[model samples]
Target chain A: MIEGRYFYPHATRFVAARASAASGMLRVEALDGSLLNEAPAKSLRLSPALGRLPARLSLGDGSHFESDDRAGIESLRRELKLRAPGGLLHRIERSWRGITLAVLATAALSYGFVAFGVPFIARKLAEATPPSIAVAMSRQTMQILDGRALAPSALKPKDRARLEALFRKVSAHEPRGAGGYTLLMRRGPGVGANAFALPDGSVVVTDALYALAKNDEEIEGVLAHEMSHVNHAHGLQRVYQASMIPAAIALLTGDVSQVSQMATVLPGILVQSAYSRNFEQQADDDAAAILRAMGAKPSRLGDLLLRLEEVHCHKGGCAPSWLGSHPETAARVERLRQETGK
Target chain B: MSGEHEAAVESGAARSYPFQFEGTGGEYFGIWIVNLALTVVTLGIYSAWATVRTRRYFRGNMVLAGHAFDYHASPVRILIGRAIAFVLLLGYNISLNFSPYALLVWIPAFLIAVPWLIVSSLRFNARNTSYRNVRFNFTGTLGGAAKAYIFWPLIAMLSGGFLMPLARRVRDYYHINNHSFGGRPFETEFTGWQIYSRFLIAFAMWIALMVAFFTFIAVSAKFMPHGKAVSPNDIAIMAPLILMIAFLEIGFIVVGIATMAMIYNLALGHTVLDGRHRLRCRLNPLVLAWVVITNTLLTLATLGLFYPWAQVRYTRYFLGRMALEATSDLDEFTSEAFGTQSAVGEEIAGFFDLGIGL
Candidate 1:
């Protein structure tokens, strides 16, 4: 008769088996009290004794089996070691499930925001823009406002020739007026040094801005930038947004009275209607590309930006009029410098 | 020795089985179901408790040479460890977002955080187990944890593109060099580079098969006589859909078989120096086939209600069939105490009445 321990680490199970050999007949009983009748000449055969336990065997008369009462099963376990099995999927399954759930939850939450958030912000911005800034005027109305005679007066031949050349050069780019953009450069009294693009893409530059330019490159750089605002349809987008505000408010409240209430805050809205930093950067890049295509040194824009910043800094509290409707001079200067690689 | 034999003869003593078997196969399913239910109800708070319960069951029921294995973990300690990990993760995220130079702060933070987590896990595992007047202690190295984190993710990404052979390499890598209590380390002589090439070949073959499948569908659709307004556009859309479904079905089968193969490879890698402690698992193609078929049918039939049950059955069958061999000194006996406490266990027990005498 022989007795020994059998360890199975993966299942975390341990078993003890007893065998008896006599008269060339051997009978082996498993730890769970099940009997095994078959014993091959040099092998041990197991039976399905324990519920889920599989059978095992040993060869060569089982001479390696030992019997000890003092040591107990624990000591036997120490002598024969077993390793626990590890699974790759089992380890990472929880993490994968967690990430997947989080992504789904985030998507569910963000769906509501996308459905309502963007339009709401756009409506608020539109309510802020002034109607006077948004609406366009007829060419006849503009001529009447300028007090021009019904019959135009003849101009001096040299002055007329110069005026025609200027008009030809300006119109060659074919600046579209779908958004009611109109360029007006004039030498007017009390109109300080300035050049600005209105929400309607109407670029109004004073004669002082032409005098401030060191050469035609700087003048052309400013012209190209204003043209980009028109070409890119930024003005039309603004007007459409300005019109959408009251409509959205009406949709939300089902009342038209709020539109008048919103009109009182229009000036404050226009004061804050500056383009986003990304938009300004895009305009600067476009201007640099256009000026370069027109055979001009794009850095001339950088020089103008530096002069504007210096003037704004010297004024301390007050900025140059051109600095309005845009970022601070320092910021614009840095952007232009980056664009022109200066 | 002769005297001992004579004593045995004189006393008429008979040899007894070395292990104590008190396990009931079906009881574990009940526990698994219950644990799963509790986890679902508690919204994952039961995870820590479940871990403790699982460790206790597996340890308490294991019978070796008439002695039972035992393990106990402090839930409070585990909870505290998790809390610390959460705080560390938050700090790491903050640093990543706010630091001017992330390279200076974020990388070190991650390195420290990962090692801390690994150490905590090992400590928890060690403090949970008790055996024969000696409590188990964890002695994991930080270097190992770092290596595991760095290489495991890379392996996951690489295997996604080259699944078949890379899967084998990953299995072998995990099994190799795994050390146990009896000074037995796992062995795998295969290299990853060799498996990578084989995976590339397999991937190419799979792509070719996919192309052929699409071509067959296209050719068949083109040859069919038009009864109605059959346009090439219609064929184009229908062909892709049919090919997609066929591809998914075949992919599931391949993945299922590959999973089994990886398991078998892992088992083969585990071996003790004395040759007694060993494990050998054979990939049962029929078992994998049944899993794929049953899962597909269940998805079609119960609309996923039977998913949990299918999962439990699959796990039970695979685990039950696993075979282990050890030296004569160590005994093998299972007890109901080791059964997991989760909802899946109950469902399994209800489906298959193994009556694991709990």
Candidate 2:
């Protein structure tokens, strides 16, 4: 028997009553021994018991019973042979060890998903994306940059042609050949030597970058790195991976304030840096291979990278480019120097 | 028994009934962590069900006048909505990456859909909530939703923020006046002037904090020895002071919380249910701010393990500050049959992080 409240169908009127499921019937009675309700026990539907909250029994006629005594309610359900949905889940919730395992597993799964699953999925998606879309994205980006910062190249016609010829050589080595690849030269007035590959294989190199290079070997090496970026469609893959961030954050803390989530910014940056770091390393290795194929020492690329960094910074340290940054830049240079020895 | 029952009737003198939340942080944590783990393990396929469980748990623990509230949304319905929302989100993200001009398409599409979505979400939540076998409901129309969520806010912004207080009043009225308990309406009323007063106070507080922050920073900088490297002693002394100053800089949150509390108190205090019982909210803004900011800091510090506790704490404090001023027996309401609402609007609103405007 459970002492609880019994409500009539579709009514807020409730009687403080005692209910008992005995034999094949359930009966609810007031304290005066007058019966309030009676139904076949099997007809009752039990709301899942959660925490120490009240458990409710629906009589299917909209009449229901509610009791705070969870044990009494569970026993009543058992006697009636009724299933309590979410019963298994609540039982696990009530156990400390289960909760502990849940926490650890959640952490592991989230980390594994972000670190491996996102990258793998994004790479597949990037590969599947049509080339027309990439071309549009690249064109829009370059147009915006042109209006905002980039100017027409100031390089002599001879120098521009020579660089374009080297760019074609690297493009020819790619499986797609040189048909789609193009060398876009622009002068960045205030911004120092810069170079980057767009999704549609437009490698934009600033005039200062060409001026900063010591020799043709250095220029060829950098061109190979940019070609690798274009060949692998790294820009599109980065965008796809970036698009997963807000969704992941929404899942984790759907209702949390932005202030509290501010703490996640550093970790989020670290994850992104980790991604770009891997890409930088791959481009470095690919550049090394291409330089060897061109019969030039890989150290020429390393020397030019160090010189570019020096030109980038007038004070403390040159801001790291998307291609490479400090510690990582040092590591890539060291690897290229090793390639030279071999 | 009839004589005793008759004697239990009130003489129209109001009595206050406080809402009690009986959930413990530890117990809720167990449920929360497990829900999150399952959602992750299933690769987000189970989030719809998880959301329902979490909402049910919260509703079940809130007791008013010895009866607990209940939430009864079907997980299957929610799952269908979530699947649609996920696809839409992926489409939006992909198109945006494909071209910035995608905004030209999405922004208008979203604006047109938002009114219907807001109304649907409100109706869905209300229809799923019940007390003593009688359901709560919202009878808001899309026209009302558009007026409150879109047109009013637009007018306020276009008016150089001068009409914001009026917009808040209109929005709150739209939310509160549309709600029904067991087929009886709840109506709320407040003057634009009242909200404007609160806004003024908030603005003043923000300005004061900005001044205080700069003053504190300048004072601290003054105390540092000029032309000398800081010693270990100074570093130790200044570190905690700097941390404290930085924490107080979340002062913006203080003003924001206070303004929210003020609005809540005004809206709830003036609310009348079936034109009989009244609702009251007496939140002291400073104290609520302290609780909220501290809760946020702790959640951040613990990397969100304290989230369940923070939610429980917030519920306890919020409900503790509310009371139902009843002038008669509270059991005469009857439910009206309403069709179940699809979860599409609710799920899409949630996906976009839209608050329910309540």
Candidate 3:
């Protein structure tokens, strides 16, 4: 007789069970001086055992028998020789060696996923995204930032028009059919001396950046860098990669329609330039190529970087929080100067 | 002495039904590690099952009066509930980005749903739990729960947290009055003013701590090495700053632990179960603080492998202090064999990471 509790659909009854090996019939009786219905042993489905946790045997007729008596259950299993498969999970739980292997495998897989798998998937997905969606998102972001950190350009109209004309001339030199590229001038002390590209083919040049640049070529170098970011959809890729872990979590938990929070978080990550070191290097190389194609000096961007660093680093040697994720300025300048033969 | 003392002494001479925890750290460690590994390998898809396995292990090992408790929550139900909760949370987060007005609407909407979630979580947990052929039950109403968990807390917060003890009283009363084992309600007579008086002692300790912190800061500033703009690079000035910072961190930790211990001891000492069964939990703040600090340090040093050991050590220490007195036989209680509870609310609360066991 097996010692277990028989949980009826509406009540719990502690019961004794007897299994007939020949006819494959199982009989259950309540231990509290009562009787229970007999059922075929074939109807019972056994759940996998984990350590001392009781295995649940479902009779599939609105009744369940749970027992911690491993010896009795094992003997019954042998007598019946029924095919009660535990799958991969049970195999791992059954022994210490399997558990160790599982742990090692899990650690390795998680590392690989985080380090390589997520970024790879992000890149592929970003590449597949329509350019129109990125453009619309970019417009929305600029509208949000306009009243917050930015204002109408304080630079003279001629100066603004000249830079806009220069940007159009450089962008038109090579048309990849990305879209019509536009130049936006903003007086943004909050963003002080920063230039960033929007996926909607808009290159924003802050007035602070113009004041820092020594000449038109230096400003052109910054514009080239921003343009490359837009050209490669780097902003979109960064957003996708930053949201990967949460997206994976949502997918695993069967939360398919929860894209709203991701939308909210995406803008911040994009503005912060949460790109991997590889993405940064790729954008820098592309910027250099674009500068060369424009017949402009590539080393001016490097010189501008050094000038900006000297001005900003004097205050306790701290970079502004906006530039926190950028590659080290010193190393980047050195590499760019090498490419420029300066 | 008193009538209660006499009855307690008489019962003490009879069978003392001491709650026993038969789980060992080493045995639990194997299960915990395995569950973590499986959950990660499955990319968190197996967490529903893992939760069940973990609860089962803990409940199965807790023995009271020669019978162990049982947890029979279906993983499928939990999975469905989790999915719904995740979607709602995601939607809420997304709505915040849609517009400022959306955020204004979302916060209150979620708050309004809290009372319902609390009720569902309680009912789900109670229905799933059974001991010796009897199931536990909760019959708390929505309005009562809302008053306890939300409105009272809001009033307390609006009053600079001074009325928190009153809120605690309301919450405890709601919880204890509604809780039942085998259709018999547990009675509590502990008053709100008693809780407030106890909390005042803790409030005084906080004031003392603040005074001490400011005094230490003043003393440190006075004793700081006077020189021509002594930089942090100077070893003479740096040494004292490092020592002072470490000392302040330790003091903060102690104050935090002491406050928690005081509140815990006060609550446990006042709680009564089944009218006849009274609980007395005597915990020393200093000892508890030391245990917690040491446990954290050890767990970190072992790279989190010592988690199960730390958990078991803490549980044993906390539960060991609790002494329950029963005036009558425990076997006489019988739960009603009707009513089915849905696991949706429990799953939703768990998924959204809300406080439920409170």
Question: Which number leads on TM-score?
Answer: 2
Q: How many clashes in each candidate?
A: 39, 0, 3
True contacts kept of each: 0.03, 0.52, 0.22
Docking class of 2: acceptable
Q: Return the DockQ of model 1.
A: 0.03
Ordered from best to worst DockQ, the candidate numbers read: 2, 3, 1
Q: Candidate 1 vs candidate 3: which has greater TM-score?
A: 3
Q: Which ten residues in a row have the lowest lDDT in candidate 2 chain B?
A: B337-346
Error of 3 at A217 (Å): 4.4
lDDT of 1 by residue, A15-48 (tens): 5766555444444557665864324433432211
lDDT of 3 at B351: 41
Give the clash total for candidate 3. 3
Q: Write the per-residue lDDT of candidate 1 for residues B124-159, one digit (tens) a residue.
A: 564345443223444445665565654555566677
| Candidate achieving higher DockQ, 2 or 3 | 2
Query: For candidate 2, lDDT tens digit of each residue in B246-283?
Result: 76667776887899999999999889887767898999
Of 1 and 3, which scores higher on lDDT? 3
TM-score of each: 0.37, 0.86, 0.75
Location of the lowest summed lDDT over 10 successive residues in candidate 1 chain A = A82-91
Cα lDDT tens digits, model 3, A1-342, are 788777664344444543333467656666653556556777777766655667666666867777778778777766766555544555566568976776686568766776678777767877998887776677778888997989988998788788777687667754443346788889886678778888777888888888899887787777777777777777777666655555444433232221222232443443335355566666666667667777777777889989887766643355334456777787777777776763
